[model samples]
Target: MLVSEVMLQQTPVTRVLPIWQEWMDRWPTPAALAAEPAGEAVRAWGRLGYPRRALRLYAAAAAITADHDGVVPDSFDGLLTLPGVGTYTAAAVAAFAYGRRATVVDTNIRRVQARVISGSALPAPTLSAAEMRLAAALLPEEGAQSAKWNAAVMELGALVCTARAPKCGNCPIRSECAWLAAGQPAPSYVAKGQPWAGTDRQVRGAVMGVLRATRMPIQRELFFAPVPELGDDGLDGTTFSESLRSQLRRLHSLMAPESQLERAIEGLLQDGLAQSREGGLLLPD
Candidate 1:
């Protein structure tokens, strides 16, 4: 449950399903993961956008093994102390894993609350104290029931009260919805979409891909090669230099600027996801 919650942060359930299953099959316990290199976790993470979560999960596993005797912490506060485990994750693990009553207010739940209780098309960009209070108030007094309600409300928002096009007709409480009662006002704030192509994230993913594809360290020159103006036709593996240059050019064109690439590499190193060794880059040991 903890691993799924962590993986599902920004990624959709469909994307996380196979990866989560594979991860569990590989490392069934925190101790199993802790015994492996942190890089293994990053490699196992595959294309799950936000690779930092992999490193954090590795660190969390090590902490659990060393401090908590390889057992996942049950209490919210205890779970919070784990690396990468934030308020929402801690609360989610507590409620879902241990059957504790937690105010689990994800984006879906927030949207559901906004439309059903506050009469808004969308929630505030950030969670407000009032929203937290309302979420806590809405949770059932009984622990088991509140946990079920938490999941149901989140599902309701995801399936029916979606941010883009809400299916009010299928909504169970559509008639009683505050937004419906108020004639469904448009959102006051304009939500900005995140840029993908040509962004640092794309570049970082490309870099990580190169690292994951090979066990040996990649040369620094290959990492910084500029994008070629034209495609290489005679770039055969027999000519090592030309082939490497051509490959690097292809990678460079897909990546961000050299400075951004360097920054991304540095960030990965700082986050313990990658290592610098002998003028080459490698996944951490």
Candidate 2:
């Protein structure tokens, strides 16, 4: 439950399932993961978007092994003390894994709650105190009921009450939906999606990809190869092969700008995702 919860944060289950399964097969216990270097966890993370979560999970495993006697903490507060574990994750684990009566408000639950009770097109940009209070209040009195309600509400949001193209006709609670009652107004404010193209995140991801692809330290110069301009290379658009075009496109991404690559490498080093070795860089050990 903890692994799935951590992996599922802003990431789809389809992307997470195989990685989670492989992770479980490799390190079935806290002790097993704790015994390995943190870098192994990052390598295993394998393009999961946010790589820092891998380090946090590794740290949590080590803490669990050393402090919790190699067992996952059942209590919400105890779980929160683990690295990378937050209020949502702690509450989720308590309610789902241990059958505790937790409020358990995930993204899905928040959306469901907003449409069903608050008559809103979407949740607030951030979770508000009132929303948290409402979630707690709506939780069922009994532990088992609370757990089931959590799953049902979350599923309803993920499937039928999606952010875009909500299947209102298929929603089980459409009859009582406050959003539907209010005539399905537009969201007061749509959150801007994070940009990826040509951004530092893309450059950083590319750097991480390079590091993850090799065991040996890569020379700094390797990341600074700027893509050659087609005309400058004496190749016009019509002369370039599809395979070469693909390679150039990939090269353009790998070598963003020398400054961007430098920033990415520095950020990765500072984040402890990569280490500066003998005049080169590699994943931390």
**Tens digit per residue, CA lDDT, model 2, 162-226:** 98999999888899999999999999997988898889988888778767766666667556645
Candidate 1: where are CA atoms >4 Å away?
226-250
Instruction: List the pairs of residues colliding in candidate 1.
Output: none
Superposing all C-alpha atoms, what RMSD in Å does each candidate have to the true structure?
A: 3.4, 5.5
Alpha-carbon local distance difference test for all models: 0.85, 0.85
Instruction: Give me the displacement of residue 3 in model 1, in angstroms.
Output: 0.5
Error of 1 at 45 (Å): 0.4
Query: In candidate 1, where is summed lDDT lowest over 10 consecutive residues?
Result: 230-239
Name the best candidate (by TM-score): 1
